[model samples]
Target: MGASFEQRPQPWVTNISIDDIHSRDFLAISKIHGRWGGFETLEKWVCGAYAGYTAVCLRDSEGKLWVGESRHDNEQGAGATEVQYSNGDNAIFVLFLSLRGEDVIAVLPWDEWWEFELNKDDSNPHIALLPLHPDMRAKFNETAAWKYAQSMNGKPYGYHNMLFSWIGTINANYPPLLDAHVVASVMTVCNQMQPAYAANMWNEALNKRLGTEVPSYSICNCLAWDLPDLIVKTEMRGSSFAELLTIPEQDDWVYSDGRSASCVAFVLEIYKAARLFDPISRSIQVTEFTIKDAYSLRFFENNSSRLPKWCNDGDDVEFLFCQIRGRYRMELPGYNTMDPYPHMNEMCPSLPPKYSRPSNCLKAFPMM
Candidate 1:
């Protein structure tokens, strides 16, 4: 019998490594600058983002998993600019190509991913891209997560749920697939200075109740007024986002109401559906630095001096970079601005009319 999207298989408890996927002679990509361009090419093609993302995972002979993040190593040297595009997709795609049918059915130890170091190097934070075993891929392919993600193949893309979905599937105890309005509400809580104002207005107008405080810096997306209810409904139905995915009319929940998914959310949903990590655990064993290393979206923007007081604490520089890079060309495009004044405030709408600038963009970055 063929496996359907809603099916959840028994967890494959066996642990595997990148070395197991590659031959004993395989070397880390960092050691070979000549090959970097090849990876960059693949990223430009598959990533489909103005700014790229980078994550690399390798396991040494000792079996210790070492991860690497894409750093800005352009003509200006390191930290001079933020990495606009990541080569992690290239690493993953290459690994998938290299593995033969013999490498199927294996699973990664779930704990390791959550436990990876963010600041592996004091100078540069890097998270390695760990490829899922063919078996795990097959396993994930049988799930609703996979089916729902696949349902979004060629739709118009939006940036709202991408970061939040990644954080939710990998970190939250349950799936964080929420409606766009819910996500907007969550963004309001995190982005507004008088956080209660937005929540109060939403409650009054929509006749709904939402959380007042930002629950965690870890949470980056919008949460529904009744997220717990949606989660419970999912548990009863056996799939979280599948129902939302099946909305055939191209409603407001999907980006552009075109019934599409963003690239990052699609990939992470594959990971979640594959059961790459324990969804129920939500332990988050990794350090603060490690989580930061793993994600491109800024989780520490609350601590950033460049952000305005009304901006979301979880707003990421990469998210802002994507917004800026998407529009309004800069002379030195690669230059990273420390003060995100006009651009920073442009994307946010949670702020009241008093806080809003002349340009009224309703969307903002995820909180985490």
Candidate 2:
């Protein structure tokens, strides 16, 4: 029994103002159907479907990267400010948010995010905000588009939800309706950028290119190749492989079938059912689904009868084969959650860790 997307909660909409970092040092590196952090790892697999940069571009034991922009009062001894990019040898400290194209870059000043109210507005401020829809952009800021953002006079960055679809900090009390108008306007460059094409098309494209079974997010990336090519890669939470591994509509990871460790069988089914091509890399990046839950993988027919009794009965054996298949397929990393403003509190870490440190590793960790 499948319910419709409408049955789900209504999608939250907000207003935002994004500015571009037109500098020579950093090029906007957008991944159209590619892996996260410029690498593939087990954690990348568990944390799949990254539609944002935070989940994809990691520190890799790195303390920080250089923010490009500099504040007027930036002193030499000032701490490493996470900015869009560092200004001149003049020593104006800035930070880099994520690396895009060969030279293009995206950045946010260190203080803007921390200075805002109760949300990511105060946390990761470097998120380049954008007006949510074409309609909102016209009514609020005139066709000026980010004029207010580009001309901020050292004030707390404020966003009207009507103008942008992004919610950084919300009004403690619902704000008053400022005003509105209708304009029969033609669309502009900022107007059209979306992951077009059906999911099936995404699947077909990746499967054809990689010569292997293309995951759902991969399908999205393949579609992205034609659409907006500037967005950071997605987060793993965008699509939950665990959600798929878990039975339909049930939060519980346990399967009703007699036994659950069916990793090898499922992997084989994936190979048979999916369109896989690259034998060398054998890569496929999945979401926040970890190897810890890897054991829960199950199949109806007997596939691992030759395995020992305990491993077979318990839902852990499937992980062993999944590890092999992961290496075999060369699965790449993907993104998880996309809410520029991530709410960690509401979201308790719900899924089990099938592999080592689902937050970090892409390939399953060696069974300790």
**lDDT, candidates in the order shown:** 0.26, 0.20
The reply for model 2, stretches above 4 Å from the true place, is: 1-105, 116-201, 204-368
* Candidate maximizing lDDT: 1
Prediction 1 TM-score vs. true: 0.23
Error of 2 at 368 (Å): 34
> How well is each residue in 1-368 modelled by candidate 1, as lDDT tens digits?
11121211222111223333311111111111234344433332221212233332333223544322222122222211111111334322111111222111111222332232221212211112223333434444233332333344223332233232222111121222434445445645554555454333222212111112233343668554433444355446554332332111111232223332333333333333434434421321111111112232221122233323322222222222111111122111212222212212212221211221233222222211
303 Cα displacement, candidate 1 (Å):
36
Q: Please list the residue runs of candidate 1 whose C-alpha ends up more than 4 Å from where it truly belongs after superposition.
A: 1-51, 54-129, 133-146, 162-260, 277-368
lDDT tens readout by residue for model 2, 290-345? 22122121211123443223221222224111111000111212211121111111
Q: Which has the greatest TM-score? A: 1
Kindly give the number of clashing pairs for every candidate.
26, 89
lDDT of 1: 0.26
Q: Give lDDT: candidate 1, residue 342.
A: 20
